[model samples]
Target chain A: MDQEVINSYIPLFKDAFLLTVKIGWLGIALAFLLGIVCAFILYFKIPVAKTVVRCYVELFRNTPLLVQLFFIYYGLPAVGISISAEVCGVVGLGLLGGSYMTESIRSGLEAIPVIQTESALSLGMTNGQLFKNVILPQAFTISVPGIVANVIFLLKETSVFSAISLMDLMFTAKDLIGLYYNTMESLFLLVIFYVIMLLPVSLAGTFIEKKVRFKMFGD
Target chain B: MEPVLKIEHLNKKFDDFTVLEDINLSIAKGEVVVIVGSSGCGKSTLLRCINGLEDINDGRVLLDGETVNPGSRNLTKSREKIGMVFQSYDLFPHKTILENAILAPMKVQKRSRKEAVEEAMQLLDRVGLASRKDSYPRQLSGGQKQRVAIVRALMMNPEVLLFDEVTAALDPEMVREVLDVILDLAKQKRTMLIVTHEMSFAKAIADRILFLDGGRIIEDSDPKEFFTSPKTERAERFLRTFEYEK
Candidate 1:
């Protein structure tokens, strides 16, 4: 509320912002890797793996990330899998984000017709080369919007990682609120910081989508 | 002379629906086989099975005296001898015409980029698309894309090329340009199996015509005999519709 108090919180907010970015980005990277793997598993319909990934996607996508984080941080220890809080938060967020990513990539793949593969196979491309060289690139370009949307959504989802005391922005804001009993100031700052950070990403998503859609569909 | 490609007792189905039933056919070295039939008669499915794009329920496809099995790891290697063009141009939208033409050569055959591009350029030139080589698939006209697709197939030096209604998606004026390219390739003695509804084009270029009805080869004979004197009632009726178009 006071000018001096607000000024003093700036340095602390900067560190918390960086921490949010660190965990957010790590979660995003893991999600991206898992997204491609899960998509391929379902795309090829690889035996038992497809069913397992299907279950994983259905489970993660349908359930709230809060419950997922809670299960990993608190519930998994009951099953004798004691993961650290940081790992729990990141992995839970990654898996949740990845579930959404799988759908995105799958939709991208399906947009390409069966004729494309037929054309590739006729040219003597092995399944591996077909997936890597032909299918993946086209899927990726078509997937740009979904990928970008998932990342931006995942960035906001990282805010919930604060529940596990991950020291992210929300957790840092809560700490400051507890210290000074200035909930309005800290909460307002939290919302402002998130909006400020996410605005560029949102804009970039639209710009990239337009450029790629134009290249692919000419509209 | 040995047949370059052979299809013996090929059968294909989609779930319970039988699309192709006990089909037997073959193409000799340098022969141009044109497949013409009403839609849903399995002409496209037959070519798809020959190139290993569709898994046949029961059949043997022999390419150059070797039995070709779609399930085998070497199937991809075997497909080097088979080229296929679809009704829709399936050129990689992201790459240039030159890149699309050279991709199979560089990736499958392990040819150097320089060597593949050099050969691709010559083929593109022959197809009259060398001037548009740097353009992407989306940039080209339907006929230009089809021409580039042909050049891409030629770059693989395929022993046989399959065209599945390649001009079906093109405009009437665009059809001749693409057909001229195929005609030139045929003159050079490229073994081709073309599935077309363009009765005139098929009659012009086909050495042999296979008229299919209800998933069976209703008539297989020279273009003059098949067109002028259809052997089956189904073939005769199918030809009647083409008369108005001509």
Candidate 2:
């Protein structure tokens, strides 16, 4: 644990941390959007689209993020489709996270009692209005815990972004260890930065879960 | 005067088991009709069928001379004219009582928030829940929640209101408060079709009492006549059970 080595590594780790946060959040955002859309598709049981979304969820959930990244970055290039490494990392993470999100959200949607739907419809709500106003709000509240978990899982999954040459936090740590061989300092900073990324997310998640539960279920 | 709602030869079945059969009835505007029966006699199913909540095997439901086609775009428009409150007091658990009351008016009827909230406040106040407008459903007693459910249905100002066992799920003490709200509506001549096991409440609130047995209307008469001297033996036997329980 050399003080000089640790101080020198700070700038590199800072840049890597910023890159990880940016890509991780973007991927998580994409995952949430994809998850909600796919969940609704399955919830409504739309004919062909439901099967397609099911297959997409299964395909992504079953495969590793590393393989998906490799396929997007290296395998697709074989077919003359070239996506940059940043895009590859974000897309790979989003595709993988989307599957988990779909299941999480789908369960939330299902947890709503049948009476809610009946109550909404009986109030003269169209299918769209009922879903948007009544179903989605309750379903989202029910989904907060699962969604927060997904966000954290997706953020941690960003560690594999190095496979696509994204220069994320993991890449910087690995590069520093290879060059300086300061295994202790590099690894320590890596753990610190990763914790810095994940701790707030988990804490924020718990806070939100509590707040929503209180709002929904009351004191 | 034309009826506000008319059910003609309605038949509903699940797979092969018949739930509602050959049900035909008409409700005039401002009439309070209470349908009472033994458990599993299709009272709730009849109300669900009237609201287009249950898919009918055959026959049609007409509101103001327009047909309601279940699972069609027409049904959505038609549903706005018909309000229903359920046994479960299905107030959105995540929403405040105010939000639960105003959601359909603001979203479905495209009313402004100011107007919806104003109307919601008035209704909530009428139901003695004005102070709890900001409270979630879980915070309220079962009786209070049911009152909120009633307010939510009334916000839509439907041509006809259907209550499917609204008070059946409430505590014995909570039952009167909810029934009083319906009685108030009955006094206002709000068209309502209620299904309840509360025989005395039915006698007090109903202009007409429908006695259903085995998925058919066995008696449709004035409340006094039906209660004191039921025409059908089945009605006599049904009323006897309530007496037996009492």
Candidate 3:
């Protein structure tokens, strides 16, 4: 029972944990914001941006998150656009998660009846006002559950960062396993980390979904 | 007399399908006009066009002597002077009934919140839903929602109100309640263009009844003459198919 080896991994574990949190949280926030903006643009079909968003969604969604991450991390350097691995991870996750976020939000937009928009228009709301005041508020509320779920999935998917040597949680765990060779202990801790991090998100999603459903349909 | 709403050869087409064609109508101020037709006869389309909700390719809708330009960038401002009630009520599910009623006045009319709420409460009272102001649309029945819809339309103090089959979605018993609200609105002398299938309701309150068939105004007459003796064969046939229960 070498508790010393496990304890030695603690500082590395702390650094890696913070990095994962940093990348995941930042990535999730940026992705959600971009997703909502791009989704609305796509939903409303706003000129060339609409087509660009469409291609962006298809490009990111159709490809693997890992490949997308690798391309941003490794491929971009060849194009003379080298960014920090941390930046690469964040941007990669943001773009990948944004693609899915756009789809989720697009579905929310579709779920809203055209009658609602027509009603808003009849009430004298400009298109921008209609989206800001009516459509976006309702759509965002409805899409909350889906967005949170996607965020959690994206957070878990951050494990793919080990491939990019970003020194995220999984990367630290692999390092520990290589040295201490305690696969069970290290893997178990990683699972615990995910569950702990994602529990609040899962609960928040359920709560938000219930509240929106209640607001929309009542108890 | 200058009609509050004037439609000259109005036509609406959805793709290759013509929904409303060559429709001509005029509604004077403070007049109640009821448009009646079977399903897909363009009655709703006509109402929507007047409110600037539908695009009409071939004609113009003038409100208060000014042509309602649907394609213009300022259509929202044009629509601000007009309010509409749908068969579905279309209340914002996220907002309380009070918020739903007050939103247009506060946002579009630029009325202060206190002023807006005061006006909205008055409208709620008119619709007999003052106590339900805090309630959401989901909490209200079909008839109550329709009544609220009527009140919501009036909140803007619109010169014209468009009701597109407001009671069609209600149950048999619920229809009368919504119609009663419309009847009450009619009493206030607000110009209203209503599209409905309720023959008796039309016969009772409408200053003029318009029978639409194949996107044309087949019969436009006073209610008494329309119910007693329709002018067109299409009107007679439509009346025969839908008998009013005495």
Candidate achieving the largest lDDT? 2
The fnat scores of all predictions, in order, read: 0.85, 0.96, 0.80
Candidate 3: which stretches are off by over 4 Å? A1-8, B15-17, B244-246
The order by descending lDDT is 2, 1, 3
Task: Between candidates 1 and 3, name the one with more favorable TM-score.
Answer: 3
Question: Which TM-score values does chain B get in all models?
Answer: 0.97, 0.97, 0.95
Write candidate 2's Cα lDDT for A130-163 as tens digits: 7888888888889988999899989999998987
For candidate 2, the per-residue lDDT at B97 reads 92
Candidate 1 lDDT over B61-147, as tens digits, reads: 999978777787778878888888889988988778898998999999999999998999888888888898887799899999999
Colliding residue pairs in candidate 3:
none
Q: Each model's C-alpha lDDT?
A: 0.87, 0.90, 0.86
Best candidate, DockQ-wise? 2
- Tens digit of per-residue lDDT, candidate 1, span A47-160: 999999999999999999999999889999999899887788778989998999998998898888787887888899888888788888888889998999999999998888
lDDT of each residue in B1-246, candidate 3, tens digit only: 988889898889999998888888888999999989899998888888887777779988888778886787667877988889998869998899999988877877789999989988887887789999999898999999888878777887888998888887889999998888888878989898888888888988999998888888888899999998888888888889875566
Q: TM-score each candidate.
A: 0.91, 0.93, 0.94
> Per-residue error at B120 for model 1, in Å?
1.0
Better of 1 and 2 by TM-score: 2
Give the better candidate number (2 or 3) by DockQ. 2
Evaluate model 1: give its lDDT. 0.87
